[model samples]
Target: MKKIVAFSLLVYCISCSPGPEKNKDKKAERKKEIQRIAVKKDSLQRDTIEFVSYNDDFDYSQLNGKKGKEEISYINDQNNDRSFLRGDLIAIEYKNDSIYIAGDGETPQNAEWIVSAKKIKDGKVSKFRKEYNLPIKYHYSKEGEISSTYLDHLYKLAEYYIANSKKDLIKISLKNKEQLGYSVEKQKKNEKDYYVLGIYVEFEHRVSPFQWLYIDPETDTIYEYDLPNDKLIEFP
Candidate 1:
């Protein structure tokens, strides 16, 4: 009876003791399960943030030139980083890890600037960079149509204003006045053909008078439109 009882006890101990290989496999399985849970949680968090679409209301032609250069430089200097300007028509979009804001530059190149906001937390931007400078180029489309010449003229006009303006910041736009809209009438100087481009310039101060800019595409020159005289005066 004693022998049989001892044998039964030994068998019980063997059944209870998990082998080393089995224990290692179980630990590995638990580790994988934990990783799976973490991945799922991260995915849920990312899904909670709503995605934004590309906005086309931002016209790059509006930023052609150095109109916003001073403001851009100042912002960068203050923060040691870059950001979009106040008058910039910015379009925003978001991906898994970053938010992107794209706008146009006030340069003759019509350079489009893109800013990426990353490491977001609680709906606030923690980090950002001015990441892209896509220059506008004129090319025939699949339909064999070139971009509007009127638009190109307006871009050059804005570039000229930024180059000459004394104000630290200025905003340019095609004049909203129906009478001052784009015109392709023949303008010739020194026997060279030219087209006229007119735009409205808004100063940062409300007390400043509204200004108009006229550009000569052929000569690449700009002038201030004298409303009363109905003529283009050479711009400084």
Candidate 2:
């Protein structure tokens, strides 16, 4: 189940957003150069806190070891200047009875949109599973207002990240009422209660992991040892 945030910290961050950018990689000359993202109004709402079922196999304790905080990095070939040689963990999450795992056949992250799992020959890869892009489960009020919703806390917290996020740097029409984040849709995997977001924000900084991203958990956090494109290992 999801836990509540420590009250004191929440109060502090809520009051003073765009407070500080956590980029150890920047020099004094660029301190005030990065664009600042203002917190949106809807992001500040409060409602009944509902907890998702956390089972033994999917327990938060599974992320307890030193590996939990261990670094994961990836190269941002597009923006080579701000790569993280040893990346930080953007977010770590999981799901169960998920359609990504609903079938049994060869399915990699990109192929997840395939409707049915295909049969594979012996010695061949079977159904593949990966973190679906930012999944959303928004609730609506009878009058069509966004009601108590499962906000993407992970993505929301990214704004408070110490790293320099390009997302903050991007120009959005919030004043024009355009949504800044990715567009969400029903899953193509097995149909489920949630919708996955397709936007991927690329963050660049002088940190060890220069090229960090918000989607694709495989590359979200790059470990000190995990190479780009190598098969990722999940802890039991």
Candidate 3:
């Protein structure tokens, strides 16, 4: 009777202990829970912060004639690192957890001006950089005598502005050509004539103008129509 009681106790204890398969299952569940928490934390961080670009506030004219990967020096903006000036639209590359700027037939170097940002929209990066240097062309045109080259440049300028400002909208509306297009017209502002590109959209056969961008053909300065204030403001 004593031997039988001891054998029964031993069997009960063995059955109560967890097996290898059960331990493996518990570990997998814990890993999944950890991953879920990590993803939630990342999402919260993204909702509260963002990255953007701004002007570096340095004179880049001294580097103009210096060509082919010439080492240049300028004071970096402490507040905003992703800073660029007008006419600094150089090529950029991302590699090995760093951003590099490449020059013509030269080795890539670390881009110190490019910095991370918070609380700014992603599209603002492109808008802060001026991408176009409009060519000098004739503004004078007789009836049916407008040069195709002039019209082409105006269309390109309008497209560039739309890409910088209306990036999200264009991605969805670009399938329909009529939904995203521009029209060139001669208009007078401040007693001076200017070539204006009317950026418009067509929906349900109805055309609606969204942006009025005026350009000086001789100087290549761009102005945006301020509808509420009833004036033309210089565009970035």
Top-lDDT structure, candidate number: 3
- Report the candidate with higher TM-score, 2 versus 3: 3
For each candidate in turn, the TM-score is 0.24, 0.19, 0.39
In candidate 1, how many Å is residue 44 off? 60
TM-score of 3: 0.39
Candidate 2, residues 59-87, lDDT tens digits: the string is 11111111343422211111212111112
Q: List the residue pairs that clash in candidate 1.
A: 63-105, 63-106, 65-106, 65-107
Tens-digit lDDT string for candidate 3 (77-101): 3333334322233432111111223
Winner on TM-score (1 vs 3): 3
Scored by lDDT, model 3 comes in at: 0.49
Cα-based lDDT for every prediction: 0.37, 0.26, 0.49
lDDT of 3 at 79: 35
